[model samples]
Target: MIGANSVLTLAVNIGIAAISYVMTIRMIPRFREMFIKANLYGKDLCKKDEKVVPESLGVLIGCVFLVAMFFFIPIPFTFGDAASAEVATTGGRSEVFPYKEFVELIAALLSICCMILLGFADDVLDLRWRHKLLLPTIATLPLLMVYYVNYNSTTVIMPKFARMFVGNTLDIGIFYYVYMGMLAVFCTNAINILAGINGLEVGQSIVIAGSILLYNTCEFLLQHQLDAHLFSMYLMLPFLAVSLALWKYNRYPSQVFVGDTYCYFAGMTFAVVGILGHFSKTLILFFIPQILNFLYSIPQLFHFVPCPRHRLPKYDSNTDLLTISTVTFRAEELNFIGKQMVNIFRFLKLISWKDHADGRITTNNFTLINFVLVIFGPVHENIVTYMLLGLQVICSIVAFFIRYPLANLFYDT
Candidate 1:
């Protein structure tokens, strides 16, 4: 027979799952109503005066309620006889386990709350980018404090040359704090950016949640680390709940968007969990796609790329010294060259292109690149596993680029 703790866990999981399903069913009509109202408002406003239809109040309220409920359910860490006995048997630090679990759960809940608030503000009031950035950073303070208190310090990975040149210093205090802050911000933004399309962000979250669960399971099995497993399980429950709820409204022709709430929380969850579980390297490997997406989108955010003169006709010739007209190339020629560059990027499978007619083309040449990188990437004891990861990456890349481009072209056109 299962112990009381095990039975409680089973009950909690079932209750949460049932609540999620019921919430999803209840949310569908509300979502549909919101969608209809928004559409009607959008159409009427567009006819009279162009204005964006504001996101529904119902959705915002629902998100807030969910976030509140998550916090309200305080699942206190039980450092009971079993846990104490286990610690004694393993000769492990006694205080660390319960505290770590507590911190992680609190961090996850805090992160969720932050995301809900930020998401609500963005969805309803249409917050500026600067505010979004600043707000989330401010909101991440609790999680950061919890992390520092529990972990004591953040880990840093320096390049071999840098390490050799600088001599290993154990005292990285303020730097660690700043690094952690930056990580939280970056992850929050990465998730927000990737939430552009239906299922994309949610799918990524599912992948992350699954990877963390697997990693935690492995840690427990191999090292007899119950803390990691327990923390991961707690984190997974809410994520799985939210994913199911969001998926119902998010699956293609999305009735309701998870918006920044889900995105920010997803990123925060990954960051906090990784830090607590000491799975930084594995998390990095698992979230490579998100990393790639961030890398690709960073330049666009800065508007660093030079625009041709013809693209900006209002610029004074004298003031705008960087105008394409001042150069030898014509605007038309530059445009053509730009198009070619895009096509070339697509050909290389480094980027994607959407033509005016809605045709999409993506390059699939990166499969070989990924394979080579994997083969030479890490000297893992489990060479076969690394080999398999390489193969999966290559296969996924090829399938996505080759088929998606065609499908996108067909549907879009």
Candidate 2:
């Protein structure tokens, strides 16, 4: 017979998969209707319309299914104060499951509501960005509550060389709240931005879930920490469920997109879990791609760089020379330069002077710099660990980028 734990996990997984299949079926027609009503069919706003569904309804149903799964799952067993007491008798210090879980769940629900309501409003009446920001900000209060209730007193800031050099002692009082609030806001926005492409945000969530699982497994091996492992297992369920469910429609030529609602909730859950596991550093490494994307786009968003212009350097077909006027550097410029360098390195021996002699652009090699970064960018405490991280990063980056061209080359009709 299967162990009780394994049985429960299997049951939960099957239940969620069943629910997701049902929800997807129920949602497709509604999605079609919404797309037709919005006049968004066969547009660049979305990739395809045959499978496209209404974002609001799909998100709402998905969230409900997720919440129900959480309640039904036996792992990360939710308990009352009495149950907490019982567990404490077994040497558990905390009588209750960490309050953070409940708080995060509620926060997720509220954020879902905000996104759905705003999306619906935008679809119907077209709400502006100001309202969109305001509504979500207001709805994020529950998240702030979680921050205050669970992490308010927690020490988030550590003393660094700057503090000692400046003769400033660390202030744990107000700083903690400020730090938590900032983290919450930043996570919410980062996830939102990362939601630009189908399956992109969900893929990032998978990376995080996998990392946490690894961390928990390591703790189990090193410290025999059953509780931590159990917690990680519990956390993995929702993420895994959502990822698989979303993937059903979000794979190549995606049918539906998990918009800000899903992305924000996923990000918040990741942040909370990372905080709980005390794996903030690991979390950062896992999410380095999204973080770098965010950092790179910030300047463009603020108009610090040229606006509404996406100019690529003009290449002379005959001379194979770049001839774009350069006044100031932009993010795209840096990216283009990097791409050129990588391409030049890749084809140094093959390309004849005649190729550039004609000033004609013959090849596009955008992934070369990305390849180098993935192969060498990972930093770790030990040489072995560093090598492992570098290899993992390279594999991941290669897999993600190669998917695009490979699909285009082989699958595109």
Candidate 3:
């Protein structure tokens, strides 16, 4: 059975999350006006009417999240543990300060704050892809430093197949930190790259956040490192709550755009919670869709194929369905090696392409959304969004299955 302090912590966290949700929902319409007056708006491309919508409203969400976190900071310490409670009750004449949790929490918040600024600046300044990609590395410095100083563990469990070859555990030392930094970069850019539809970004974030919550709740109930799970819960609950609020208006007929800020904020939230809560490995499992999307996009991401500024699905007005958007180049534009790679991928049925009489070749951009379109053909934008979100859920379920029943095949759980 859970104790009083644990129950109290739940109530307080839930309370703050709910309030933040309500605040975001209520403030969006008001913020929309300010955004429009400040010229922070963009025209919707997919729609025939080219509707105007407020942009960078995600900055508002990030600000509210930070404020809510400030209030949440004190509650965790007051109910953290016997030591924290004693220190709170006594004047600290002889009690030990709860330095570890305090520092970790502050560092996590600082890292998130930095990412928020990066995202906001990118939205305002239209930072180049190279610069935007590398900025996340700077934002993650605090998180890495905290991990190095507070709870550095460089060892990784060897898989069953490898255990016989190289024992049960292998220590890679500093490479682990490098891996975490890469994870932060991936987390920040994944949703941003995968976005185009109205609610797709926030919707996927909600699913991933909910998946993390489910796993953390299970771990909490099992009493497998309660403090860590609680920390995850505190970060995730508010994230899910605030995201749902945005989703209400950002769905099919979108009223506002989430922009780069929300994507970065959401990804950094997952990164921060996963790192601090000691479940970074498990956390990665929940991002299967994003991972697959990134892998499939390697060809286009590099100079192999000419990448466009916008890879979103084409909105066909004739049937009112979304179709795969393609990058077309003259047949001569592709060198022998690039053409060979394209032919190989086409033969493998990984992509679809068309040739025109004008001596040009066109192929779908490498993205999960386009991949689905290649399989299903044209469909409504909302239906496409649902299909991808459903895929995310399935991937998460597979992750849990692998983490639990199939554990013996992978590692010592």
Best by lDDT: 3
- lDDT per residue as tens, model 3, 277-332: 88888888999999999888877787677789889999998888899999988867
The order of the candidates by lDDT, greatest first, is 3, 1, 2
Top candidate on TM-score is 3
lDDT at position 176, candidate 1 = 70
Ranking by TM-score: 3, 1, 2
> Candidate 1 vs. truth: CA RMSD?
13.7
lDDT of 2 by residue, 28-108 (tens): 555656655765433223222334344533354446546655565444343322124233333655454544554554555
lDDT of 1 by residue, 1-413 (tens): 22466446545654665676566657665555555565522221111232233233324434633553464355333422223322322456444244455456667577657766676666567676787678667767887778777667654544444566655334577877776667767777766664433345565666567666765665555554565555556566656665766665554434555656667667766776665656544456665655665554332344322322122111123332111111122224334545555455456655322333333332211222222322353222123223333444554444335333543543331
**Relative to the true structure, how large is the alpha-carbon lDDT of every model?**
0.51, 0.48, 0.87
Of models 2 and 3, which has the larger lDDT? Answer: 3
Listed in order, each prediction's TM-score against the native is 0.61, 0.57, 0.95
Q: What is the lDDT of candidate 1?
A: 0.51
Deviation (Å) of 349 in candidate 3 = 2.1
What lDDT score goes with residue 201 in model 1?
57
**Regarding TM-score, does 2 or 3 come out ahead?**
3
Query: Which ranges of candidate 3 are over 4 A from the true structure?
Result: 85-92, 335-337
Q: Each model's number of backbone clashes?
A: 1, 17, 0
What is the alpha-carbon lDDT for the whole of candidate 3?
A: 0.87
